[model samples]
Target: KEPGSGFWLKWLGAPSCQRGSYAFYKSVSSRAQPDGPVQVWRLGEFYFIRCGPQDPVCIAEVTLLWEDQTQRHLLASTRLYFLPEDTPKGRTREHGEDEVLAVSRKMVVRVEDLVRWSCGQPAGWSSSLKLNGLRKPPQSSDSNDKNTTTNTTDKNGPVERQGVKVLSYPQYCRFRSLQRRLQDGARGPGLQDPHLLALGAVRALPNTRVMYCRDTFNHPTLESNTNFSWQFSEYLWSSQQISFRPSACIPFPLFV
Candidate 1:
């Protein structure tokens, strides 16, 4: 039997094959049930067998018998997991859990986190394909308004911000000052001091004065004042911290 010859029918008592060429054979478990010989054959990746009335052979029925056995074997060996038949109508479970992982309210998961988690799986393994179209963050309305209102009627057009533009002396001076300040912090801001919070221009919250004094200075004055120490610790720890790196280019734009 040449490979890719399609079907092998030697077991049908065809003269083309020698006696022992067929790998599968017919057999009965008991003698009480007298039945005709069952035809058996192995073709490519599958094994097939068929048995029925011996006279006026029905080839269609024999083919169907082989198909039924193949289907039965396939279904028995395969494992399929489906949502529980009794799950409540509105309920859902999260993926990969016996019960779906569901949220009653709207939820957002970060793209970076999701990519890191599913880097190697097939497309179907994803939670939903609808969310795959990359969406950009909405541009700030204020910024859009500023661009739209820029005067474009005059030949000079008030020296439009885009394309070649002229800068006033004060604007040039301010730019120079900002350039100098950025140069001074080339390694980026450290995590300590009034300099630390002020360099980043972080907005201060209530009780920040006391908390900043305690944590930034580690003042000895708090030692004699036991009552303030506990409260100071709590306040200091509760503050949200931001860590940023100075970049030659805007990093977030590159990702989008």
Candidate 2:
């Protein structure tokens, strides 16, 4: 792999994994784990993929983790699970926000699209450990220890923990699987440890607004952030989806 080997160029363009032309990885560190205990994605595990700059994230099962040869980029091939809202019937209180409907739709996305679980998710995604059986990070520590701090570093500098920006629709992101119907699709607590909720408190960022409105004609429509300024005039609301995304049952408040 030398300069002008066409890695970055192909990567920037977002090339898909070419058939018979990639290398495999046993696991991949999450591209967007906010704090640190570290989220490592492995095969046969569930995770989320970013769809667009502002669109809601989608949860999928990792089938393969590979590097696209031509682009020299790491990529993930996942089988997506849809929301009941994504179905024709829509959502219900019976279903936990973190639960997802199983489906066979698969897609290839840049590993950068893979994000970790969020704060305050249902118990199914976490076990007694909260890390869901994943291995602990190197030199990781409980934030309770105020006098001691440790971090592994390389030649360039100290390895700082990276955080991802919050999205408006966390409902679409994944955590646990939808179980038997008798349980009302409720998911039990799995295992999770967000770096001690990721070494400290979750970041406090202002949440964007997503409004589902009715025009003078009384037709339902959605008015979201500036980036959402699409031609929504003729758009029709789905009976299955909510007025706006649930977003953790949290209000879309403009104040604190």
**Candidate 2 C-alpha lDDT tens digits along 28-67:** 5432223334345555444444444443344455665557
Residue 47 lDDT, candidate 2, scale 0-100: 42
Q: How close is candidate 2 to the true structure, as a TM-score?
A: 0.35
Evaluated at residue 174, the lDDT of candidate 1 is 48
Candidate 1 residue lDDT tens string, 100-202 = 2111211111111111121111233223211101111112335212112121223332322111111223443443354355456542435333443233322
> Each model's TM-score, in the order given?
0.14, 0.35
Which segments of candidate 1 are over 4 A away from where they belong? 1-141, 145-162, 186-256
Question: In TM-score terms, which candidate is top?
Answer: 2
The local distance difference test score of model 1 is: 0.20
lDDT accuracy of residue 191 in candidate 2: 23
lDDT value, residue 198 of candidate 2: 34
